[model samples]
Structures are given as structure tokens and as C-alpha cells.
Target: MTKRVVHYINQFYAGIGGEEKADTKPFKEDGPKGPGLGLNGPLEDAEIVGTVVCGDSYFNENIDTALPEVLEMIKSYEPDLVIAGPAFNAGRYGMAAGAVASEVITELGIPAVTGMYEENPGKEMYSKTAYIVPTGNSAASMRKAIPAISGLVNKILAGEDVTPDKDGYFPRHRQNYQAEERGSLRAVNMLIKKLNGEEFTTEYPMPEFDNVDPAPALKDLKNATIALVTSGGVVPEGNPDHIESSSASKFGAYNIEGVKNFKDGYESAHGGYDTTYADEDADRVLPLDILREKEEAGEIGKVYNTFFTTVGNGTAVASARQYGEEIANQLKEDGVDAVILTST
Candidate 1:
């Protein structure tokens, strides 16, 4: 079956005015318009079923508000896949393409792809979320970029295996498997050959992260004794671990064993927000003071004295999980009761 593909572009590509039309809201159109024609013409099993255009600023400033509406538009079409820009280097356009592509892929369970220059900020922001082809810095490369995007769309719609070099695009961390055996031994031999200046193909390519199921809600928070966890790097004064404010090295658990109040002396190093609340009183974040108050008031069971803290920004998902697991194990061992984690 030919895949029903939808294309996303900014107002300019949709035949709307220049910067003036950048704020175009999504509306269903009967067929391709503007560059949508290029995509619709060559894509074989795919048709440009819908075009979603929004101002770059609109998407960035109003993402929370815009996403639902955009999603609602996409749902009406029921496209088999979604495609967005060969955005070149237009900053806002690149970001809009990536953001829309990622949301459709995740929220709607549809495959989405985008194209942008290596320098575009969106490349870094949404590269992990969807297919991002390396594009020329401007529309001069449109002919080349569109064909590349078209080829990848063909492969995706047909469920064919694709590679970075063969597809003429940067790797999106998507992995593919081959039938023939080329175990680590053969793979290292190939790598050694490449190192010695011989031609070789890598055996295992880094695959994009499979869609992650949202973290399951804490089970039985009221009865099962839920513990609070955050990567928001809420920590005590001086950051004893010297953990960087954004890129944390290791999480630390502050011992509030005998401390009565988080007043006067403590501080937070978390850089996401004004650390004042977390800093002026670490208790505001760890809420140890409040938790203790609650425990004393019989509002809850015993308050766990030591709570875990770590930097949330730029922290890898893997590192966060490891911290949680370690802290959870410790909590189980110490017989500390439920936890209430506060984020900064």
C-alpha cells in the first residue's frame, strides 16, 4: 500500500508571505502546495497528504499551546507518516520542523522525518527524536536535499533497511540488522582495516532510541510509600560533590538526620531556576523540614532523612536511572519511610 505521508513546512514554503506569514496556523489543504509539490512529485508510495505551516516564533514561544492544535490537525488526516523541512539553516524553521516531527512521531505513533543543516540548533535538540538529514545551508541545495529526503521516505514507507552513507544523510542513531554473521571479532578486524586505511563497513550502527514509554506513575503513592527523585540537582551549600550545576558527575544524598531547619545557611547549585528556594532553604527542595513537620503531624509516615539529588539539565537518561536505582536500593536497606521529592 502507498503510504499516506504528510509534509510540514513553514509559511514561506507553503506559498504564504515571508516573515509576515511565519505565524501561519495549520489548516487542511486538498493537495501539495509550494515545496510540497517537490515532495509529492517524486515520493513513490508516499503522497503529501497535508501541509502544516506555523510561524517559527509561534512554535517556539507557544509550543505548549500549539502542539495540541497541530496534533489535532494531524489526527484528522490520519497520515501513515509525517515529514518536515529540508529546513536548511533557517533557525526557527529548522526548530519548527524538528519539534513538529518529534511530537507527531511520539504522540501519534507515526514515523516522522526532518532535514536541516548541521549547524541548525534543532539538529542537536531533536536529533535524538526523529530522522534529521544533513542539508545544505540554503535552498540552493533544495534539489539535492529533497531527493535525499524522498529516498529515505521511500525506504521508510517500504520498511527497507537504510544506512547513513547509502541514504546520503547523517546517522540518526537508528540501528539496522543484517542476516549474515559479522560478530565482534569480524567487526574489529574490519575496524582495524579501516584504521590501516582499508575500506570497511561498520557492523553495528548506532540506532536511535526506540520510543520510550513514559516513566510509569509512582505506584500507590499514598499507601506504597513513594520516594521523590529528580535530576534537578538540588544539593546542600558549597555543593560538596562539586557537581557541576548542569552536567552532574554523580548524585549525592544529603543527610538531614538531625537537622531541624534548612534556614539561614544552606543553598542550592541547581541552575535551572532561581536557586533561592532550593538555596535559601535546601528544605524547600528536599522538603525535609516540611516532611518532618508532616511526619510529626501524622500527615504521613516517617520522613526519610536522606534524599537524593542530582543535576537535571543535560544529564543522560541512563545516568538518571542509575542514580534512582542506587538510591532506591539504599532506601530499602535503611528502612527509611516514604519520600516526597521537590524539583527546582
Candidate 2:
């Protein structure tokens, strides 16, 4: 029997518009649209019964409302399987796709799949929660991504066993069945292979480093309201917030208004690097003293008084991204035009 599938995509793919149309609300079209059209050939017996197009910004900003509304639309089609984007490296689009895939799998209790690059933030946050096929970094990979995604969807809907290595998807790290050998035995066998210079595949693989594209350079540095931020874990003298030296749970905002030197009472809370030098002078890490000089010298405009700091060591990329986002939002609202970020 042919399976009915619902395709989810962002406004840009729907040919509605690009970032300018990213605020478009959730809407449905009768059949395949944009990339959904690419799926028809490879999907074989499965048909895209309806296409759900939502704006990247709107869905993320209003997820609570958007998710249910999107799920409702997909439900209208009564699809046996659901597919979201091969979102590439787009941060917001990847997030929306991952989210839709998550709900389709968890809430709808159906086979759902999305594709994205390994480094996409959405992969880090949702890959374990959903079935995510790894794709190239851009839509240029669309042709290749479609078949892989569809094939897996078909296999899942047909109740076929799929492995991460055999199929090109990220590992979900779920142990749904029992292993013949205990974990200790497997570890010992793998260790012996390692010692004997033999091949071994680890059950769990470490995640790749996150891909963070830096913001565009400031066109008007002399007029920009610059802010200071650090992952060096620099904080007040007494370590008031007690941000962990490693795997910091939270970041802190401190007032540096008109303060020239960190030596006044600042120190490094970072545990990754040697603290001796940073202890004597936090400026060694944050360099706010030099920034103040730049401000006074009129080389740049005003310095944003509120400086943000966090410890990067052993902190998950998800946590770091959350901190960066929260800090960025406040900085944008406060009219801070630019930021000088330092890391150790």
C-alpha cells in the first residue's frame, strides 16, 4: 500500500521569499511544493499528500503555538510518515526541521526524518531526540540528501532495521535492545583490539565541534557601541556567582562602567588554563583595559558597561549557544552595536 507523507519546509523553499518572508505563518498547500517535489521520484510508493510551509523565525519565536498548529496541519493529511528539511547549515531552519521531526516522532507516534549538517546547532540539540540524517552544509546537496532521507523513511515505515553506519544518519545513542556481551566485556574486547592495533568501532562516538560563524565585521567601528564578552570565566574578585571553573552552569553579567583596569578587583574563574597570571590581572584575558583606552582615545565609540562572561571548558555546545543567544538578545535590546569576544 502507498504511504501518505506530509512534507515540512520553510518559506524560502516554498518560493514565498527569503529572510524577508521568514515571518510568514504556518500554511498548507494541497500537494508537493519546493523540495517536496524532489522527494516524489525517490519516495516511490510514498506520496506527499500535503506540504506545510512555515517561516523559520516565526516557528522558532512562537514554537509553543507554531508546533501544535503545524502538527494539526500534518494531521489533516493523516500521513503515515512525515519528512522535514534537509536543512543544511542554516541554524534556524535546522532547528525548525529538527523540532518538527521530534514532534512527529514523539507526539504523532510515526516515522519522521530530517536532514542537516553535522555542525548545525539543531543537530547538537535534537539529533538524539529525532532521526536525523546527516547532509552536506548547503542546499547544493539537495539531490543527494533526498534519496537517503526517503530511503530511510521507507525502511522505517516498512519496519526494516537500519543502522547508522549502513544508512547515513547520526547515531541516536538509543540502546533499544539487549547486547549479547555485557558492557564490560565489550569494553575489554575493544581495549584489547586497541592494544593489538586492530580495528574497533565504539558504540558511542564523540560529537563534533559546533560550527559558529562569526558575525559580519562592523562597517562603522568608530561609531559602534562595543560590548565586552569572554568565555575565559573572568568574574568579580570574590567569585560572587560561583560560576564553576569548568562546565559552568551559567554566565554572569558585571558592571564595568568606566572601569579601566581589571586589577581593581577582578580575577579569572576559568579552571582550564593556568590562573596565576589571570588572577593577578583579568585584563590579560578580557583586555577591557585596552578597550577603555580605545574608547578614551576616540578610536572607537562608547563601550557597553555590562560585560558578559562564561566558562567554556567542558561546557556543552548547547549550553554555550544558549548563553550566547541570551547575551546577544540583551545586547541588541540595549543598543550595543558590536561585541569584542575573547576566549581562552
Candidate 3:
């Protein structure tokens, strides 16, 4: 019998709209929409019985409500396997895909698979819970992603043991028994190769490190301007920018000129922590009040009028680095001599 597959995709893939329509609720389509069409031939012996489309923002933002509703939809189809997006590196989309696949596997007791970029926050969070095939950083890799995911799905449906290296999925760090040269002998061989300056691959590779030299201390704090930056997600109440609560795609800049404290109309958008205190007094997270007091006492020259904020929870390093560079450039242009960055 042919295996039945239930496919999930986001609004963008469903031809609804991009970020603007990202709050669309979950809905179902017949079979093979968007990338699902490409998955058809590759998914041998399996047919995409239905396609479930959802908005990335909606799924991540309303996970508790959306997940069960989506699961019920998938369950109605009675699929043998559930396939979520090859979400690439889109943080929200990847997270949604990972979450859907996980729910299908755990709640519905069905096999599920999803795909994403290696560095996508979703891969780190859900790889162990669902089979996640690695794709490139964008949907431009859809062609490659579909085939890899479909091939893995075939293996999984066939009851074949699919290993990460062999199946192009992210490693879940599952230990497997393998016959190989003894560890001591392997170590000696590696050492011999190193001593002889011969090419050798270590069984374990050391992680690369990013080294940053610290800047010299401010020569005159009384005359140097300082700015505030934070990944704590503190923002004016109602969040004008719609900055995501998790896996934030954009950073916000707010004017604090002549402002003494974060009183009413200020709160945290970060979804990872308790918002009670931050909501009551956002100054606890950004500390603009304390900085202002210091400036008044001549402990610092001045506080820059603008502060940068973004949610750090589950945000991709690449996105963070981009935000950092942009924020730094803005600060430099404003003649800010130093910055205080906070996180939550």
C-alpha cells in the first residue's frame, strides 16, 4: 500500500503574502501546493494526501492553540507520515515546521520529518525530536531540500535505519555501534601524522572560536557619550514594530531623550521569560533610569537619546550579528563613545 503524507507549509509558500500576511491562521488545501509539487516524484510510494498551510507568525505566536488545531487537521487525513517545511533559515518558519513535525510525532504517534538550514534556531531546538534534514539558508535551496527530505522520508517509511551523515539530516547525537580501529591506535596515528606534517582528519574537531580584542577604557567618562542596547525585548507597550517575541527578525530603536524612566507604555516582548517584572518596569531590563542618574552625577558624560532593542530568545546568530553591525554603525554616526548591552 502506498504511504500517505500530510504536508505543512507557511503562508509565503501558499501564495498568500509575505511578512505582511504572516498572521494568517492554519488552513488546508488539497494535495501538492507550492514546494509540495516538487516533492511529488521524489516521494516514491508516497502521495501527499493533503497540504496544511499556516502563517509563520501565527503558528509560533499561538503555538498552544494552533498546534492542536493543526494536529487535528492532520489526524483527520489519517496520514502515515507528516512532512513539514524545508523551512530553510527563516527563523519563524523553521520553528513552525519543527514544531509541527514534533507534535505530529508525539501527539498523534505518527512519523514526521522536516528540513531547515544547519544554523536555523529550529534545527537546534527540534532536531532531536523530529527528523530534520539540513537545507541552505533560503528557499532558493528548495530544489535540493525537497529531494533530500523526500529521500529520507522514503527510508523512514521503509523502516531503514537512517543515519544523519548518510541521510543528510542534522545529527541528533545518537550513539551507534561501529567497528573501527582502537581509540589509542587512532590517536597515535593522528599524532604521527601531525608530527610528520601529513594531512590527517581528527575524529573530533575543535570548535572554532571568535576572538574580539577589548577596546581601551574611556579616557574621560565625564565627557564621553554612552548608548544603551539590549536583546531583552523591551519595547514600548503594543510593540509598534511587531518584533517577534522569539527568533526576532528585526531590532527596534526608540527615542529616550528627556525620559527619566520606563514607566507606563513599556514592556517586554521576549517570550522566553516571565514578563511580569519587565512589564511592570521595563527599566529593570533596560535600566535607562539608572543610566540617566549616572549621567546627572557626572559619572558619565551623556546618555544617547536612542536605544536599540531586540528579542534574543532563539534568535539566529547571523541575524544577531547583522543587527549588531547595523546598531554599531548607527551608534558611531551618533558620536556615542560606549554602549551598554543587556539581555534576557
Candidate 4:
């Protein structure tokens, strides 16, 4: 039996436009468009019955409204499977693809698959919820991405058991039952190998932590200009930058020139933690008040007028790294000698 499939893609892949058209609304077409063209050849018995196109920004910005609509469209097609982008490393596009694939699986009870770079924020957000095939960081990888994704989709539709290592998808971390000796025996063998200085693989591997060398102590605290940076999601009242409560895509730089304390108008946008205390006095998270007190006491030099903030909850390491680099550059340009970075 021929399996029906629905493909989802953003505006850029639909031949509409690039970032400029990122606000385009959701729409549907008869079949295969953009990368879908490559996907069709490798899809085998799975036929793409329809293609849904949406702008990355529009889908994410209006996810509440967009998801139901997109899901309804896919549902109407009654596809046996749904496939979303090999989104690469484009943050918004990757997010949209992951979201759509997840929703289709959960809400529609249909098997769905998407592809993205390992570091894409969407991979972190939805890898466990959906099958995300690994892809290169840009559309230049489309040729490679399509084949892998299509093959996976075919396997999924056929009810074949898929493993991350063998299938090229991100690990969902689902435990697999295996017939083997007890853990104690395995540990004893590993210890023996370690004592003999022989290479051995452990059944469970510990994650390596990144260690940062501490910077030298400030030589002149009373003269150094200090700056405040936070991942606590503090923003002026309205959250003008629209920074997301989770998986933040950007950071905001706010001027605190003569502000003595963060009050009612300042609140936390972080969704990972309770906002009660942080909202009442954002200084609890950013510590602008303490810094001010230290400045008044001459314990430290002036505080930089501007501070950088973003929600760190579930934020991708890549995005956080980019924000850090950009923030550091701006602080250096503004003559900040040191920074007090706070996080929830």
C-alpha cells in the first residue's frame, strides 16, 4: 500500500523570500516544493500528498494559533507520515520544524520526522519528542539531509525499529533492554581493565564538564568599571524585545544610568524558575542595588550604565555563546573593566 505523506517547509524553502518574508502566513500547496523535490525521489512508497509552507518567524511568534492550523491541514490530508525540514542550524527554522513534527506525533498520533544540525536549539527542545535526523549546518547539506531523512521516514512508516547510532538520528535517550550480566559484574570488569591500564568502554558514560580558567583578580576594584549581565530574563516592564521566556533567541541591552533599584516595572521573563521574588525586586537576580551600594561606599568604581539580559531557561548553548561574545564585545567597547554575570 502506498503511504501518504505531508511535508512542511518555511517560506525560504517555498521560494517566497528569505528573512524579509519570515512573517508570511501558513499556506498549503499540492505537493513537493523546494527541498521537498529532493525528498520525493528517495521517499519510495511514501507519496507526498501535500506541502505546508509557513514562515519561521510567523510560526514561532504565533505558535499558539499556527500549530493548530498547521496540524488541521496535515490532518485533513490524512497522511500516514509527516516530514518537516532538514532545518540546518537556522534557529527559528529549526524550532518551527521541530515543533510541527512534535505536534503531529502527539496531537495527531501520526509518525513524524524532521532533521537539523546537532546544535540547533530545536534539537535540544524536541529531540526526545520527535525523531530528528542529524544534518549539516546549512541548506548546502540538503542533498545529504534529504536522503537520510527520507530513508528514516520510510523505515518509521514500515514500523521498523530505529536506533540513533545506526539510523543517523539524534539519540532520544530511550532505554533499551538487553540481556547481559548484572551491573555489578560489568563494573568489576571495568575496574579491572582500568587497573591494568587497558582501554575499556563503560556501559554508562559520564558527561565531561567544561572547565573555565578563572580570570586574574581585579588589580584595582575601586577603579575598575563594573557591568551587570544576567540570564535571569530581567527586562523593563513590557519586555520590549519580546525575549522568549524559554529558549531565548536574543538578548537585550538596557540602560540603567541613574536607576537605584529594579522595581515593579522590572520583571523576570524566565520560565524555568519561580518569578515571585525576582519579579518583586529584579535586583535580586541582577544585583544592581548591591552594585550601586558598593559604588556609593567607594568599594568599587562606577557601574556600567547598560546591562545585558536574556532568558537562559532551555536556551541553546550555541545561542548563549553567541550572546556572550556579542555582550563581551559591547562591554569592552564601552570601557567595562569587569562584569558581574548572574544566572538563575
Candidate 5:
């Protein structure tokens, strides 16, 4: 059976108007045309059964709408694989390709692939989610990226096992079933050989995560009263609360009547990093001194004294949550509203 593959492209590559038509919503075409020929030519066992073209603007602006509609159209064909542009240097186009490929793979569980230049920002964003081949920064590299993806798609359609090295695509930490057996015993022997100054290659490799998500901004600061909390330990001298140094289950609160900030006697017992600086001025980590300054400046309504603490670095999530709840209960009793938690 000929492998049926669906191709996705932007308006510019679809031979439609360029930037002016970048707002085009998705539409289906009968078969390969223009750039689609590149994919069809290399994929001898595969045929471009359908094509989806959308304006870059429409894809980026109305992704929720465009993706579902485009997916609905592609679903009618029931292709074995979905392929999108390895969008070279085009920023918007690269992003569109990544977005569409990720959506199709996630929604349909169909094999998906795309190509992008090494320096292309899209590679950083979506390479792990889909099979993205390395390409040049110009249209000149299309020939290379297209054929690479096509070859991989053909193998996938044939139900053949493909690996990161053999398929020539960026890995997204996805695990595949290994047909050949060589469990732990074999692996240990191979390791022993390597330790004996013999060259050896391990079939399995560790995966990488090149993507990161920035922390979300604090919500509702205008009308909400904010509190201060930290992983820094600024408990009362002589360790009155007896809070555990690292995986603390309890939190402490000190009376800041005449205390401008934590003195030399107050210290952090966290085992993660050097807490020397923070110990000298506990406010450096908790920033109660700054909050007090802000309060004196009328920047905030109130400064909740004696911020919460726990050693974040090796602390179990369950312990952290329990400690948090305890401190939160105290804050509630003291009429504390919101919290500014500083993590190390």
C-alpha cells in the first residue's frame, strides 16, 4: 500500500499572495503542488494525499480555530503521516509549521515531521515535539530538509522502527519499543568492557529538554494585600521553633518589634548553597527590610513580619506542601492576605 501523507504549508509557499495573504485561514487542496512536489518526489512509497495551507497571521492569531478546522479537513483523508515546512529562516512561517505539526501529532496521534534551519527559532521551540530535520537558512536547503523528512515518513508509514540517529531527526525524549533484547545484564557487560579501556556504544541515550517555561506573574496585586515568604531561615535565636534545617515540617515567626532585620544570631540552616550572605542579613533572602522600607514609603498596606521558610533544594514536595499549609494557616490567623514567595 502506498503511504498516504498530508502536507501543511503557509500561504506564501502555497503560491498564494505573500504577506498580504498571510491572514488566510486553512483550506484543503487535492494533492501535491509546487513545494509539495519536493516531498512527493523523495517519498517513493508515500503520496501526498492532501494539503493544508493557511496564512501565517491566521495560524498565529487564531490558532485555536485554524488548527481544529485544518485538522478536521486532514482527518477526512486519514493520512498515515502529517508533514509541515521545515520553515528555514522565516520566523512566522517556522512558528506556524511547529504549531501545526505539534497540534496534528497530539490531536491525532499520527506521525508528524517538519524541517528548520539550525539557527531557526522554531527548532528551539518545537524540535522535541515533532521530528524536525536540520536544514540550511535559505530556500536552497529545502531540497535537503524535504527529502530527509520524506525518507523518515516513508519508514514510519511502513511501520519500520526508526531511531534518532537512523531517521536524522531531533529527539523529543520519546521512548520507542526496542525490538532487540539486551536488558540490564547485557548492558552491564558492555559497561564493563568500556571500563576495561574498550570502545563501546550504548544503544540507549539520555534525553534532553531544551525548552523552558517562565514562571507566571503574580496575580491581582492592585486590590490584593500581599505577604512576604522565603526559603530563607530567619527563625528566633536559639532555634525556638526547632524547625528542621532542610526538609522542615514546621515554620517559625519572630516578633519584629525592635528588630530592623535579622541580626547575627539569626541564621539559615538550608544545606543547598552557601547561606553566608543571607545569614549576615537575613532580609537579603526574605527582603523583610525592603518590604518594611516599602511600607514606610506607603508603597504597600502592610508588611507581614516573620516570613515563612523551608530548604527548597532537596526537600520532598509532600514535606514542602505540609510546611506551606502550616505557615499558611498561621498567616490566615494573622489576617495575612497574599504572599511573595522567594525561591532559591
Candidate 6:
């Protein structure tokens, strides 16, 4: 028996405009469109009967309304399965795809699948809600994404076990099957393998997180090169970089070569916390005032010429990680040996 499927894609994938047209609302059409066309041919056990198109911005910004409308459209198709975009690294698109897939699976009790980069905010938001196949950072991986998605769909309809590792998909962070051995036995086996320097996979894998080992302490604070990095969204007056108050897509490096404190004109771009206090005294967030005091007292080395800043309010983990890496690289190049990182 063939499984009926519904395909979802953002504006760009449907021959619609990009950011400018992102306000387009939910719409539907018969048969597959865009990436779905490629996916349709490869799916052996499923047939895409309808395509639901929604703009990325519209879906995300108006999710309260747009999601229901989109879900209604998908429900009209009465699909046995739903396949959303291989949204790649486009944050908004990835989020929309994940949202659609999640709704279909949880709300409608239908199998839903999508593809996106591992770092996609969608994967972070909806990995447990949907079966997501991994893809490259951009649509350049369309060829690869389509096939991977198709494979998952085929296996899903055939009632095959779609493991994340053996098959190529993000872990759903769910385990519903029984294990052959008890938890303690598996743990002991894993420990033994670790002791012998052998490879052993954990029965229950934990979520991914940065396990940064502490760096050796700076032996000489008086001679150390200290730098300030913040996700507190503090910025110079006027926010020249136009860094967002939330979900900041970029970071700014301001020249503080002569700046001793933030007294004259600095403010917080962060939206997660009260901006009044931060705007009134940006040093409260970045703590440059204290650092300056320590420098003047010769308790610590000079503050680096530049300070890194970004708004962490609602920022995706992937974006934050990227910003941190970039900032670290620049500081390393400048021979900055120590950093004081602040966050809201």
C-alpha cells in the first residue's frame, strides 16, 4: 500500500521571493513542488499528494495563527506522512520546517520528517518532535538532502527501525524499544571499554553540549592580556552595528582602546532583560568599569583594545557557538591570554 504524503516548503523553495516575500501566508497546491519534486521520485513507498507552502517569516512570526492554518491545509490532504523542507542552514526556514514536522507528528499522530543542517536552530528546537535528516548548510546540498529525506520516508512507511546513527538523521532523543541488557550491565560494559581504550556506544546518549575543559589559570595577572566578551548586548551609543536586541545574527567588536569605562554613551541591545539599567550604565552588564579599576590598580594587565559584544536573547546555540569561536580566534591572534565572558 502506498502512503499518502504532504510536502511543506518555505517561499523560496516554491519559486516565491526571499526575505522580501517572507510575509506570504499559508497556501496549498496539488502535487509536490520544488525539493518535493526531487523527493517524490525517490520515495518508493510514499507518494506526495499535496504541497503546503508558507513563507518563513510568516510561519515563524505568526506561528500562533500561521501554524494552525498550515496544519489545517496539511490535514486536508489527510496524509499518512508529512515531509517538510530540507531547510539547510536558513534559520527561519529551518524553524518553519521543524515546526511543521513537529505539529504533524505530535498533533496529528502522523509521521513527519524534515532535513536540515545539524546546527540549524530548527534541529535544536524540534529534533525531539520530528525525524530530521541531516543536510549541508545550504541548498547546495539539495541533491543530497532530497535523497536522505526520501530514504527516511521510505523506511518509515515500510515500518523499519530508523535509527539516527545507522541511518542518517538527527537523534529524536527518544527511546521506545526494550534493550537486551539492563542499564547497569550496559554501563559496566561501557566503562570496561573506556578503561581498555576501546570504542563503546552508550545505550542512552546524552544531549550534545560543549564540554570545555578549564584552561590553566593565568599565572601572572599583572602581566596577563585580558579581554572582555559579552552576550549582554552592550553596545556603544546608536548601536552602529545595528545588533538585534534579540536573536542576534552577528556580533560586534568595538574599539575601546582609550575607553576606561562605559560612562559616556553605551547601552544594552539585549531584550531578554531590563534594558533600563543596562542602558543607564552599560558597565553593569559588561563590567568594564571593574576591569578598568583593576587595570589602574595594576592588579591585572591592560584591557585588550577591542571588546566583543552580541545579544544573546533568544539567540540559537549554534550562532552563539560560532560567535564565541570567532571571538576566541581574534583574541588569540592579538595575544590575549585571558577573557572575562559575561552573559545575560
lDDT of each: 0.71, 0.86, 0.89, 0.88, 0.73, 0.87
Candidate 3, run of 10 with poorest lDDT = 170-179
lDDT of 5 at 23: 77
- Pick by lDDT: which candidate is best? 3
If both were scored by lDDT, which would come out higher, candidate 4 or candidate 6? 4
lDDT tens readout by residue for model 6, 1-344: 88899999999989988766877899999999988889999988678999999987677668889999999999999999999998887677878889899999989999999998887878888998899999987789888888788988898899988798888788787667788998899889899999999998776666777789999988999988899999999899999987766556789999998788886789987766878988888888888899989999999888898999998765667788899999999999999999999997
Per-residue accuracy of model 1 over 216-268 as CA lDDT, tens digit each: 56544333433445566665667787654543447887766677666655677
Local accuracy of candidate 4 as per-residue lDDT tens digits, 1-344:
89999999999999999767888999999888888888988887778889999987788768899999999888888899999997887777888899999999898899889999888889988999899999987889988898899999889988899898789898777686874888889899999999999999877766566698998999999999999999999999989888877667799999999998897679998877999999899989999899899999999989999989998865667788899999999988888899999999
lDDT score for residue 276 of model 6: 90
Model 2 ranges with Cα > 4 A deviation? 208-344
RMSD (Cα, Å) for all candidates, in order, is: 14.3, 12.0, 2.1, 3.4, 17.0, 4.1
lDDT of 5 by residue, 78-178 (tens): 98889898677665677778877887788899988888775555676787787788777678877677778888887888788988777778776767676
Winner on lDDT between 3 and 5 is: 3
Judged by TM-score relative to the true structure, which candidate is superior, 2 or 6? 6
Candidates ranked by lDDT, best first? Answer: 3, 4, 6, 2, 5, 1
Q: On residues 1-344, what C-alpha lDDT tens digit does candidate 2 reach at each position?
A: 89899999999999999767877999999889999898877886788999999998688668889999999999999999899987887767888888899898899898789998876777877888788998887899998899889899888878789888888788877768889999999999999999999999988776566577988888888888999999998899988987766545589999987688897699888866898889898899998888888888988988898899988864545568889999999999999988889997
Q: How do the residues 96-203 of candidate 3 rate in per-residue lDDT, one tens digit apiece?
A: 999899888888888899988887899888988899988988888888888888999999988899887688787666575674888899899999999999999777
Question: By summed lDDT, which 10 consecutive residues of candidate 2 come out lowest?
Answer: 312-321
Q: Summing lDDT over every window of 10 consecutive residues in candidate 6, give the lowest-scoring window.
A: 241-250
* TM-scores, one per candidate: 0.54, 0.65, 0.92, 0.82, 0.52, 0.75
Residue pairs with backbone atoms closer than 3 Å in model 4 (clashes): none
The list of candidate 1 runs beyond 4 A from truth reads 174-344
Candidate 4: residue 310 lDDT (0-100):
96
In model 6, the Cα lDDT at residue 116 comes to 83
